[model samples]
Target: MQLNVERGAPATGKTIRLIQTARASGQDEHQIITGNAYKPADLELLVRHRISRGAKVICIDECSEQHIECLQRLGGRLPDELTIHAVVSY
Candidate 1:
């Protein structure tokens, strides 16, 4: 159960690296959480749903204005057995 956050400038491959790092530990079961696909208000519910479905890695895309806030809202809602890799590139 490792929880880490990686952040860098946009287009620096930070997100890709995080995904790869997460996959190294998971069995190809990573969930990509993007703001474009889900509303800001529904991110928590969706992330929790994905996690419950056995998502080992969570990638919070940097394209959303509330990405950081969304990450913060996830404070203590995740399972200890899961690995979270959220990259914020502003």
Candidate 2:
């Protein structure tokens, strides 16, 4: 599992975007996941979706601490391919 941290993940207003709508390739994939980081259930579900669907990257829009914690807990499940792009705003 490789980890990539970046700023400015896609989101809808104050809420995070919570679904994988597209596939990225070759140096273009920073990693993305969909879900409201503030919501624990959403974070868990979104992360699980990535695992179940075999997504290579996890991108959370408006990522909160819960999102990061969720990743730390379940990230190992992803095994070989895993990328995380966490967005934070100050």
lDDT of each: 0.64, 0.54
Please report how far candidate 1 places residue 64 from its true position, in Å: 4.1
TM-score of decoy 2? 0.56
lDDT per residue for candidate 1 within 29-90, as digits (tens), equals: 34556546667668767777878888766666653557556656666666777666666666
Point out where model 2 deviates above 4 Å. Answer: 7-38
Task: Give the number of the best model, judged by lDDT.
Answer: 1
lDDT of model 2 at position 48: 70
What digit string (tens of lDDT, one per residue) describes model 2 on residues 1-90?
654434443443322322332233332234444335248666776667766877666656565666666667766666666766565543
How far residue 58's Cα lies from its native spot in candidate 1, in Å, is 2.0
Global CA lDDT of candidate 1, please?
0.64
lDDT of 2: 0.54
